[model samples]
Target: MDRITTQAPALVLRPWDPADAVDLVGLCQDPALRRWTNTPVDDEAGAVRWIQEQQRGRAAGHRFAFAIVESRATSSEGRLAGHMVLKNVTPGGASAEVGYWTAAHARGRGVASRALRALTDWAFTTFAGDGLARLELLHQVDNAASCRVAQKSGYELATLLPAAPPAFPRDGHLHIRSRSAQVSALVDATRR
Candidate 1:
């Protein structure tokens, strides 16, 4: 497993830990987040479980979850700004789905977009050996903010998926980003 630690000018993307459970609880309490994700992290135990589940998923090669931390100089430095993940990874790593949520305070600061971009870059660069070829992001049809994030992260709106069972039980938009030709060329050059 790759220990991913990607940094941007304003944020850092690292693995989520047990120490982040408290912050996760608070983030889950935000009504807007709840409405979007339908997560079960309303309390400490749930938050712990969330962290544990992410670890398990990573160990199983099913997902890679990250904590979005801001690079600040104040006491709140390193606070949990949000969560981002590459989930529903297919066997053989041909593709994966990206998902994210911003904490209430991080909502308008472009945290989600920046972290997502960093995560996408890392995934493409690190997972080519595992056969990763593309990544996808999906959001409810009415989620304009998420749409903007997808666009900012270089994912193109591919299609509209009708309300389906389980994960997306509502109409949604699918966004996709394939491993770019430049990256593929670079990989080939390195191989030679």
Candidate 2:
């Protein structure tokens, strides 16, 4: 698959490149980032492997992972601000899971929520003809910031999920944002 480059008012989201391994390693260094999500990127080698996984996932059309950067970035090489992915998509599937994380430098600045909105918009636009109906975003119960991001992205809390030990160590919230709901919310947001 060709690389995807998406944009929002404040962001430019492109495919994860091997060149971003250094930035990934640095972003993964934040304890809060590590504690909130599980991506297994602790070092440069891990970062490279993770990036390859993203590439492979894209090739397989099972996931679309994006490296988020500022649209008007200061550096020639846009500083990596965050990451987002639409994972677990099956061919002509009705739903897909979305996940994201923001670097410490970008936290509390609406990066996650805005990038997620961009990704969600892209997913629905790109996959709707394939029967995509909704996006699911899950996060551990303790992740208040994540919960906020979900809400801001117009995903409503749908259900509670039990902890799956070793993988999901805590109870989680499953949020759902359907295409109809997203359209309404987006229209409302634009109106406001």
Candidate 1 clashes between residue pairs 3 or more apart in a chain or in different chains: none
lDDT of 2 by residue, 79-146 (tens): 78988999999988999999999999988988888888888888998898899998999999999999
Predicted candidate 1 versus true structure: per-residue lDDT over 156-186, tens digit per residue: 9999999886777789999998888437646
lDDT of 1 at 106: 87
> Distance from true position, residue 153, model 1, in Å?
0.8
Best by lDDT: 2
Tell me model 1's lDDT, rounded to 2 decimals.
0.83
Backbone atom clashes (below 3 Å) for every candidate: 0, 0
Give lDDT: candidate 1, residue 25: 92
On TM-score, the candidate that comes out on top is 2
- What overall lDDT, based on C-alpha atoms, would model 2 receive against the true structure? 0.87
